[model samples]
Target: MSKKNKDIEVRIEETNRTIKGTNYVINQLSIGKKLVGEVMTLGAKEHEAFLGDEDLGSYKSVDLAIEAILLQHNLHD
Candidate 1:
């Protein structure tokens, strides 16, 4: 892990809205003060499973992906 990873906390926020007459929840994630990303929930079970992860459950959206990418890059704090 690199210093950058240790300094960052990734958070995901869920938001719901209608697009083209369809309702969808968007997962918006913030990483420290640097990066942001989004993810889409396909089903309740899937979302719940995702939320079950100890390290990532609290993150609402793209935080998981961002964390994975950062970890892969060894960008730890």
Candidate 2:
């Protein structure tokens, strides 16, 4: 295969893998695997952060953010 064709094939494979991973994560979250992990930040202000419509209070700190998510999941269960 040509180099261009090989690159395209690689991209297609990567896309397929990403789609599969996303589907698996969705399935797990649906099964109640909430509070996955904490987001790594360089500052106090977050640029982009959201997980569904889950109102998980304010982000006081990384630990607090994680704690709030855990509480949310515990309460929902």
Candidate 3:
């Protein structure tokens, strides 16, 4: 967490869930305990990013998915 973005606090953590034989970890993006988005692995190299209930898009990696979620959340700082 950086102090530069003081308006909201962003946090991502692992969840106990797996799909399609992929032991994926769902990162819940939250702002001060309020969940705004999520990122999870679909299978192989495919990852899914979402905001609220809307699908942001499919990504190739977890980092990319997180980036998309952050961009959609407008928390790029």
Candidate 4:
């Protein structure tokens, strides 16, 4: 595996799981071994995503949140 692939593999091994039909994740990101940020999805179609302890807010769809969050971080950078 490539270095990026290895990094992803190490972080994501058992963090993905499904209950009912909705997907929940306990995502942890790090640079090498140093801790970074974490995010989580809660609920079904209509849901909220959390960043650490902050509310990223609610969205009608994950796609919407994905676009909005990416744009948000891009602005920060």
> Which candidate should be chosen as best, given lDDT against the real structure?
3
Return the top candidate by TM-score.
3
| Clashes found in each candidate (C-alpha, N, C closer than 3 A) | 8, 0, 0, 0
User: Could you estimate the TM-score for every candidate?
Assistant: 0.46, 0.36, 0.71, 0.43
lDDT (C-alpha) at residue 20 in model 3: 65
Q: What is the alpha-carbon RMSD of candidate 3 to the true structure?
A: 5.2
Candidate 3 weakest ten by summed lDDT: 1-10
**Sorted on TM-score, highest at the top, how do the candidates line up?**
3, 1, 4, 2
lDDT per residue for candidate 2 within 1-77, as digits (tens), equals: 65553321101011111343452111112223333323233245531122346544446455555455456655765
Candidate 1 lDDT over residue span 1-77, tens digit each: 65553554766677896879988776655566544444555455333112212233333334454455445335443
Ranking by lDDT: 3, 4, 1, 2
Q: Which lDDT tens digits does candidate 4 get at residues 42-69?
A: 6566645444355678777656655555
Better of 1 and 3 by TM-score: 3
lDDT of 2 at 12: 8
lDDT of 3 by residue, 3-67 (tens): 57456667888895756676777888887878878888767788889888889889988889888
lDDT of each: 0.49, 0.36, 0.81, 0.51
Deviating ranges (above 4 Å) for candidate 3: 1-8, 18-24, 75-77
